[model samples]
Target: MKAGFVIEEHVVVYCDGCGDHYSEKDNESICFHSIAQAIAYFSAHSATVGWVYDGDRILCDGCIATLHCLQYGHTYPDTWQTTVWPLGKLTRSRSCAECGIPEIEAQS
Candidate 1:
């Protein structure tokens, strides 16, 4: 848990750019680390919720899913992108486990 370490005052998390959360190892690649923590945190917090990233500091589980899709790819009802903003809108709920894209009306 917590990036192979313990949670403490020094263990900084939460990326403001995309709201992706991660542990602080006192380095530059904060996004990748935070993405890892986001995944675990959401998994424990929400069985259906997961985390993704956008190459910057963003700890939001919603962001994580988007990141996953960016690096990989995603699919949906086709009309899904109509309501949400690109890279900002997360899977409404549990997305295709493979794509990580949320259902049009689901919550990530």
Candidate 2:
């Protein structure tokens, strides 16, 4: 009896500034049953986390939550902003189903 569907998600994070991407290259990308679990993972590793939508990129649930927190005056730990530029903003635009991050309109 299959009551629910099993979703296999592969989340990837890319640093828009440096073009560095993180994924399952060596099993580093974590797996979760729900978006909450994914958000927890990012909260734990927010230090090196980034939020952006390049091309055909599916943001992990955590990325969206982190961005939302930042936009809503949520302060991050010192380590989270360690490498961040003195006056650099997190990202230009993005969107999330769970969070209220603004969505970027597609250009014609």
Candidate 3:
């Protein structure tokens, strides 16, 4: 089995034409080292992110590649845009869908 590598700080990686994590914006293939570095930085900080995979029997990777973007001052948590609702959050206040008889309140 091939072993995965952990990335060190501030190292440069060149693509090996596997293109698994390759992007046209990068103008070359993606390599394991570059991906490891990106994964390290991303996992270090808390962020809501997503990814896609390609190719068969071969693996490659990439990342947002911003070492200090959030540190430079971004507002709020990563999931802030998800919009949770508090309409039925009150305890025993007759807010449930199946309690048609009405709720007498949790303290009752």
Can you write out model 3's per-residue Cα lDDT over 29-96, one digit (the tens) per residue?
Answer: 33435555655643553233222223212222322222123334322222212222376333333322
Global CA lDDT computed for model 1: 0.50
TM-score for each of the candidates: 0.27, 0.24, 0.17
Task: Give RMSD to native, each candidate.
Answer: 13.6, 15.5, 17.2
Predicted candidate 2 versus true structure: per-residue lDDT over 7-88, tens digit per residue: 5565444444444454544737544666555556556665564443434343544565666676775432222212233465
Residue 40 error, candidate 2, Å? 1.0
For model 2, the stretches where C-alpha displacement exceeds 4 angstroms are 1-29, 49-108
Cα deviation of 17, candidate 3, in Å: 17
lDDT of 1 by residue, 58-83 (tens): 34555655666788777554344434
lDDT of 3: 0.34
Give the total clashing residue pairs for model 2: 0
Segments of candidate 1 deviating more than 4 angstroms:
1-13, 20-58, 78-108
User: lDDT for each of the candidates?
Assistant: 0.50, 0.48, 0.34
- Assess the local accuracy of residue 74 in candidate 2 as a C-alpha lDDT between 0 and 100: 48
